[model samples]
Target: MPYIASFDIGTTNAKGVLVTHEAKSILEKSVPITTIQTEHTAEQNPDQWLDAVLKITKEWLSVGIRAKDIAAITFSGQMQDCIPVTAEGEPVRPAILYSDARAGKQAERIKDELGTALIREKTGNHMDGTLTFPKIIWLQEQEPVTYEQTASFLISAKDYVIGKLTGRLVTDPTSAATTGVMNLEKRTWQTDWLERYGIAADKMPEICPADEVVGQVTEQAAKKTGFAPGTPVLCGIGDAGAATIGAGVSQQGEMYAYIGTTGWIAIPTKEVTYAGEGVFHLTHPEPGMHIAIAPLMNAGNAYKWAMSVFGTNTKMSDKFAFQEMEEQMQASDRRTSNLLFLPYLNGERCPVQNPDATACFIGIKATTKREEMCIAVLEGVAMGMKQVMELISDASDYKRITLIGGGSKSKVWNQIIADMLGLEVLVPEESQYLPSMGAAALGFINLGWDSDYQAFSQRLTAAQTFERYIPDPAMSEHYEHKYRRYIKLYPALEPLFETSLDSE
Candidate 1:
């Protein structure tokens, strides 16, 4: 069986997964990448990504997965980061990551220069620091030499790797949409948008469908990474977009919630869409589909923080750690009862859209125990999801949801999401490999192994029997009372969080 290699170039790490056309896993490995930080910027060396990719690919090849059997290679990547390359395809500067908010000033300037209505209508995304356009503008002003020397900008980790492999430059529509440089109507790069930001039109890659064949692996890349020299390289999608398809979120109203380092609520849609005010609607990796989205910075990270801060001794044993914590919660009758948590540890996106937002624990009692507070931390993250769902439910009534990522593994967290959101949650059978499976599915479709996506998806994905937990009537009521109050705490403390920052 021909195997498809999927590279997921994530923030903080790069992962390579090898899977057969039947969606069977062959081998997988990961390598870490650094996130360089300043007071206001989070950047990663594009070369670090290249190094990690090579490390991971070599590790996979060491396990006996040969070069020739690898029929196609594709990628899923951290969304919205811009990777600028020279005409000769060398990275000009470190990538501006998705979480970096240094472009706030540029974002405001762009909105003022081109009005929000026109921006949204054209880009199908909100005017935010997270998009590539503002970041590109920031680069132009701050690093004029680098900006002038660049050839084309690619919008994902995988795109950078693809460029390395084939020496060809292009980006898929989903990735391009996040750049705020794609024409939502024409389904191509918007030269007008690029020009508005003073970006040369030649600096953009050819916008293509996710499954479009871009080029073949060059001799250098094939030898360095062990992929065959002539293997077809497919233009892949953003990680979330690929994962959504991997989890079988196709057609209208099918929703998926992915919680890894960050958390997101995505609803696949048919007709070109917009999130109005509080959300972003970006093109999906699958051609002709779009997704309504709300992403939160600190869901899994919040849990990781709690484990590190309070349960450090048992951090590696997440299930055991959480099991003991939940036992404490039940013993105390949900004692974190009135306490509420704002899960903005690294600021917030999606519904709130505030980068300066800070996490806070409110209603702490004198008797609040460490474990009880830990449970509140968990509940607080769920509350954040509830807040997003409330906004989404106001626009669309979604009946069922699919869950993915690290959070999906925890039954306690899964139940919390279900109870808090008041919805049925479905986890895919290949729960851990959704993005890889999605990437492989793309290759399968392109390789003519599957006739239609629907048929392939049905065979490729199965719903894991989710341990459903309906909202506890009283607990739900308590959350309603707490969430109303929780909503006020942020605004009330907003000035204080900002004021404290100036003192530094």
Candidate 2:
């Protein structure tokens, strides 16, 4: 039987998964991508991503899986990147990651020129500095030499690898949407917007459907990646789009939450109306559907920080540190803790758009224990989720939630989320790699193995049982009181963030 190999190129690393027809993940590998970071900027070398794919593919072959057995390859990766490449697909410079907000001035200038209402009407998103188009403008204005020599500015990490594999500089609408240039209604590049910015149309990548076969792997890519020459490659969607479909959440009112290194509450909808600022409307891989997203820059990573700083010691192994922390948190007898944490370690995206926001613990006293502080970290992220859920759903009868990603593995955190939101949380067996599996849907379709994304998603997720966390009715008043307090802290703290940054 043939297999589909998918690569999820994320912020800090590249994760590769080999999936079977039954949606079973047989082999998995991860490699770190070197990041060059400074104040208000984040960048990566695209060659490291290509090297990771090569390493993972060869490692898979070493384990007795033949190169020919791999039927097709696809990708679901980090969106809204700015990677400038030459004519031969070589990187003109480092890639500007989605997290970087150095283009704040450019974003405001774009908004001033085009007007936010017009941009929102065309793109279904707010003009934010963290997006690709603004970063491209930053490049053109700040580094004219680099911008002038660049042939194309790639926006998705996977698109760079695809160009190496198939020599086609193409991207899907879901990925293109993050560029702040794609016309969401037409599902194509809005050349008018690009032309207005004096960005040449030729620099844009070809827009393609997610499920369509773009081209076959070239002989050069074949030699490096250990794949059969002419192996088919697919135009895959963004990680959020993949995760939404991979979790089998295409139907209206089927909402989901992802709490990994980052977090978000997403609802698959048919509406284009802005629920609120920072609520991203991403086009689903399946046509005619849009995934309304309320994004968060913090989640499990905040818990990770707490674990490292407060939980771990030099003598403890990483595994033991995690075990110890879980034990400690579970050991705490307080049903409703008095402490709180603001999980803005890397700043925030929704509810408030401030990048200067910093994390801090509130209600700290002489009596406050480290264990109580750690528990507050989990509760803080849950509180953030609760706020995003209410905003994104917009009282549209959202019943249950499917929670996925690394954070879903937390028993304490999941219960906290369920209690805070009063919704049953379902954590799938394919929690972390769900997006990788979602990329396989297109590969299966290209091979004539599946009819459509919905059918493929159904087949992939139907047999899996989820870990359910039901909300406890008794804790309603307790959490309601806490959430009210939690929401107020951010606003009270927001004014200070600006002053602190200005001083810095």
Candidate 3:
């Protein structure tokens, strides 16, 4: 049986999986990639990603996985990263992460020049500092010497790996769409827009379809990764697009929610559907499909914050922290509570595009208890997701939702989402590997082992059982009322957030 190697280069870690032609996992490995985060900056060395991949491949080869057995390799990575590299594919500096907000001034300049309406029409996304163009502009203004030396600006994390492997600077349409420089309708780089922003055309990578064979493993890469020389490498997609296909969301009106450190609600559409401002529109990994995305900057990380504040003094282990918190949440009243939380710990994306937004606890009083606050955090994130669902529903009707990612492991959170959205939520078995599996599916297609992704996905997910969560009628109604209040808190607190003396 031929094997395909899939890689998912995430914000915090890089995961590798070997899958059979039939899409069964044979072996999996992951290694941490260090992220250098500061108050207004988040960066990671692109070299760290290559190191992690090398480590994973070395371990797999040591365990008797022959290089020749692998048919093709594909990647899925964190989207919207700014990695500037030399002509020889060496990073000039640390990669600016998607969460980095140091390019706010540059983003404002772009908005002033191009206007948000034109940007939305051209790119299908709003102007934000987290995007690729603004980050590149920041490099030009703030670090001119380095920017001048930079030969290419890669967008997605996997693109960096692709550069190192094939010595070709290229990106997939799904990843390029997030760069704020791609013409969404044409699925190509917007060279005119880049020039207007003072970005050279040569600085951008060539765009390719996610399933196309962009290059092959070079002799150096083959030696380093234990792969056969000239093994085909497909132009893979961003993690969100991969996860969408991986979660079996191939049809129109099908939706999925991914809650990692950040969270997003994505739905496949036959045409471009803009869900107002702050929502993202990107090309799906599958040709001719579009994904309407609403992303929240904080989701699983909010739960981490709660655990740090409330679970630190307890004797519970990290693994059981969420379980204990779930028990606490279950003990609380199901109807409603006075406390509400704004999950803007890392600012926010979608709905509200403010980088100055801060996390806060509202409706706190002498009667507020610790458990109520904990449950409030869960509800707050759920309410945030509800806002995204509403935006998506505005564009298209999606009744069933598939939930995937690290946050899908929590039944309590899943229930809260189901109740908040008043929709059926299905959590797939082995949800964490969905992105990798999606990448593997792309590899299979490129190698002619599969005719289409939809059929491959259906077959792969057919045997997988999902835990279903239905909305409680009473709780759904209660959350509907609370959601009204939750939406109001952000606008009411906006003035204060701008005037506050807090400095990043």
Candidate 4:
């Protein structure tokens, strides 16, 4: 039986899933990877991503999954990464992650030199430090040697891996859209914009559609990954695009929220409509559609931080802390507390684009304990998503939203989102695997096993096993009143995280 290998090179891990043509899972493997971080930098060794995938595939082979049994390979990976590479497909430097915002000045320069409206009109994004173009500029100005040695720049993690596999230099439209260089409508790079930014057009990879077979595994990649040398590889979409498709959001105006290391709320539309500067527009996996995503830089990571702070300090392992925190949050009474948390631990992108914003607990009393603070963190992230949902769609557009991600596994957080949105939140049993499932669906289409994204959606929806969290009427008013105040707190605090005195 032919199987599809789908991988998501995520911020926290490299996860791969093997699924049949009809999207039935065969085996799954994940390897945890490290991230290097500081005040203004977040980076990972792209070599780690390559290493992780190789290790996973070897494990899959050990389990009797033949190399030739894998019919096609596709990927869903982190977006907006600035990875400089040599001609030999080696990473020149650690990949600057999407959360890294060290290019604020460069972003401002682009917005200033080019008209704001012109940039927004063409790129469908407000020029910001979180994008790839400004980060490239930052590399040129700050680290001239790395910039000069770079043969090409790639936006998504999977693009780097694909280059190593097939020696192909190509990116999908979904990843290209995040660069703030592509003409969002045409799904092609703007050569003139690249020239204006002093980036060579040749350094940019060719933009390809998501479902196309852009490359085939080389003998070298086969040696490293234990895959058949000539196996076809599809140009898969980015992680958000995968989530959008996996959640069965095929119809227009259908919305879904994904909470991983980062989080986003997305709704598909027939036209590209400008909601705000923070909102992101991407070409949908299916052609001629757009997915407007309002993203949160801090979601599951905030929960991770809260556990580190409030959990047991006796050990560094999170397995114990998570179980203990889950019980405490569930056992505690959350009704009386008016405490609110701002989940901007790494700053925010959507709802507000302030990169220097900080997180804080408001309305905390001397009597407040760790349990209440933990509950506030969950509520705070949920509140942030509520702001994004309103931005991406009309109030009536999304009757219910499919929520998928690592955070979707949390029953407490899931219920909070349902209560906050006043809508049903469906968590598919395979929430953590949806992005990879979406990748598999694309692989199936390329293999001629499925007709279109809608067909895949219908097939998956009919067989999906999900846990539904219905909205709680008793807590809606409580959350609604708190949300009114949570929306106002950021504006009041923005001036505090302004331009650094030491930056100049």
Candidate 5:
């Protein structure tokens, strides 16, 4: 049986999955990619991403999977990473990650010069430090020597790996859209904006359709990784887009919620729909489709923080931490809790685009227990997701939402999201592999294993096994009241956060 290899180059790890032509994932592997972080910066070496790919491929090959059996390779990855490479595809330095805030001043300058209306119309996104343009400007101002030596700027984690394998520097529309450089309607680079911002046009990589075959694995890449020479490589989509496809959200108005380290509520749209500022409109992997996304900086990480604080006992094993937390959350009343949490632990992106926003647990009294705090964290994230859901609904109506990513594993959290959104939520089996499956689906279409994306998506959707959650009317009413209070927390705390940042 022919197989396709799909790679998901994520923030914490690079995951590889081998899927049969029938869409069954036969084997999967992963390797950690370190994020070098400081106060306002986060980065990773591009070479490390390649290394993880090589490591996973070697492991798969050793297990007796022939290189020839793999028909094509495709990718889905973390977006908004800025990797400056030489003409020969050598990294000038470590990549600037999407979470890096070192380009805050540059981003502000770009916003001031370009104006919000023009940027929103051109790029389909707001000006933010977590974009490639600002990071490039940061390099030009802060490290002129490095900037001068740079040949091209690559966006997304998988773009760097694609360059290394095929010796071609290219980006897909979905990934390029995040750079704040691509014209959303045209699906190409905005040369006028580049010139206005004083950014060189040559630094931008060529944009390609997500499933187009851009190049093949060169001899060098074939030797380093265990792939056969001349294996077809498709220009892949961004992780969010891939996850949308994998979750069976291909038609207009179909929606999905992704909860990884970060989270977002994404809905597929046929036309360019703009939700005011702080919401993102990005290209979909499928041709002529767009995805409106409202991203959150904190989701699973907030849960992780709670775990670290409450699950540090010597007897507490990592395996049991989730179960214990779930039990704690279920111990509390489902309808009411006096405590409220603002899940801006690492700042926020969607709904409120504040970088200095800090997390707070309001209504904390002497009688509050640690268990209530944990429950509050879950509820806080649910409320934040509901905020994004409302923003998407402002543009279009979506009743059913498919949940994917690490956070989907928690039934307690899933139920909370359903209750908060007052909508039906569906969790697919093997939800974490959604992104990889999406990439594999693209690969299959590019290789002619499938006729078209819509047909492929339908088959995959029909095959998917799901668990559905229905919202309780009483619980939904309770959350509606709490959500009103949650929206007030950020405005009330904005002045305090601003003062702290200014003092620092």
Candidate 6:
């Protein structure tokens, strides 16, 4: 049987999964890469990504995986990371990662200059550092040399990989949507926004559908990666969109919640599901759909931070810490931590696009143990997620919620979210790696492993029972009071964060 290969280049690593055409997993592997950080920038070298991909592909092939039997290759990747390539398709500078916030002024300028309605009509997203258009403008203002000489702005990860495989310079619609360069409703690039932002439309790649075969593996790519030369390379979706697709939230009103380093609540919708304000929509990396998205800056990352401060020094291994933390959480108090945590470690997005927000721990008493503090930190992240969900609920009625990601692995965290939202959270089998798995499924669909998306999703996804944690009436009352305080704490602290930055 012909097999399919899919690559998911994530924020901190590159992962590849080789599977049968039927979406049965055959082999999976991951390689870690560096995300270089500075006071004002968070970046990854595009060359580093290419190197990781090359090494990973070669390693997979060395395991006796046949090159010729691979049917098609596709990708899913981190979005909003902007890397401008020279006319010859070489990196102009290190790619600005999704977490970078240096483009704040540019984002504000665009929103002020272009006005929100025009932007809303064009990109279907609000202007912010998280979007690529501001990053592009930032390039022009901050690095004039690189900006002037650049030929195309690539939305790193998938685009870079596709460039390597097919020698074709293009982007998938889903990825393009993240760049704030595509009209969500029209399914085409927003040329006027480019003109307004002083971006060169000529330099941008043509937007293509996620499942469309944009290019084929070259002789060079095949030789290095042990894949067959000329295998079709399909335009791939953004990681979040791909995860939602794989999670089977394709129809309107279907929702997904992911708690990773960052957390987000999304609903796949056909018409713009604008809830007046505070909710944003981006085109699903799929061809003709939009997904409402709101992100929490610190979700799993907040727990990791707490563990680092109070638990064993585990070198930031999420698995080891979670296993150790889970055991301790069961023995701890349910409602009384005497500690309150806010998971805004890296500022915040969605509902309140405040970059000046900071994490906080309040009401600590002498009786507060390290374990209690850790649990409190987890609770804080849950509350933060609840804030976003509440914002989403203001717009639409969300009934069922699918949970995915690293933090979702924790029973404690999962139950907290379920109780907070007062909804049953479903965790499908293989939920943790939904993004990459979605890419693999898309690879199969594009390769003709199945007829349509619905058929493919049904065959690929396996439903599993989730341990439900209904809200405790008393604890719910406690959180309701604490949540009101939590809401007020951030606004009070916002000015101080900005003041500190100014002092520095």
lDDT of 5 by residue, 1-504 (tens): 688899999998898999887788867887988999886788999999899999999999999999999889999999999999999999999999998878888989988988988888888888888899889989998999889889999998999999999999999998898998789989989998778767789889999888988899999999889799999998998998889889888887677899998889888887665665778888987677888888989998899889888764636775688788888777778665768999998888888888778899999888888888888898999999988778777522656789999889989899988888888999998888889999888887887888877777787777789999998999989898998999999988888888864576
Kindly report the root-mean-square deviation of model 1 from the true structure over all alpha carbons.
Answer: 2.5
Give the true-structure RMSD of model 3: 2.0
Clashes of 5: 0
Sorting all predicted structures by TM-score, with the top scorer first, yields: 4, 2, 5, 3, 6, 1
Clashing pairs in 6: 174-285
Q: Taking the tens digit of each residue's C-alpha lDDT, what string does model 6 give over 361-435? A: 888887778788888888888777778777666423765588887677788877777766666777776566667
Q: What are the C-alpha RMSDs, in order, of all predicted structures?
A: 2.5, 1.6, 2.0, 1.7, 1.7, 2.4
Q: Each candidate's lDDT (Cα)? A: 0.77, 0.85, 0.86, 0.88, 0.87, 0.76
Residue range 454-504, candidate 3, lDDT tens digits: 888787888578899998999888898888899999989999889866653
Error of 3 at 446 (Å): 1.2
Q: In model 6, which regions exceed 4 Å deviation? A: 276-278, 285-288, 314-319, 394-396, 463-474, 501-504
Query: Against the correct fold, how does model 2 do in TM-score?
Result: 0.97
Question: Candidate 3: which pairs clash?
Answer: none
Q: 2 or 3: which has the higher lDDT?
A: 3
- Assess every candidate by TM-score: 0.93, 0.97, 0.96, 0.97, 0.96, 0.93
Better of 3 and 5 by lDDT: 5
**lDDT by residue (tens digit), candidate 1, 82-138:** 777897789898888888988889998888888888888787777888789888888
lDDT of 2 by residue, 1-504 (tens): 678999888776688898888877878888877778785788888999899888888899998998898888999888889989987889999999988999999999999999999999999999889999999889999999999999998878899999999998888888888888889888988898888889998998888989888989999988877899898899887888888877878778788998767878888888886767888988987778888988899987898788888975836886788888888887885474778888888888887798889888888989888889988988888888888887777543865799988788778778888888888888998588787887877788777787887788788878577899998876656888888899999989888887854576
TM-score of 6: 0.93
Pairs of residues clashing in candidate 1: none
- List residue ranges in candidate 4 displaced over 4 A: 313-316, 499-504
In model 3, the Cα lDDT at residue 14 comes to 90
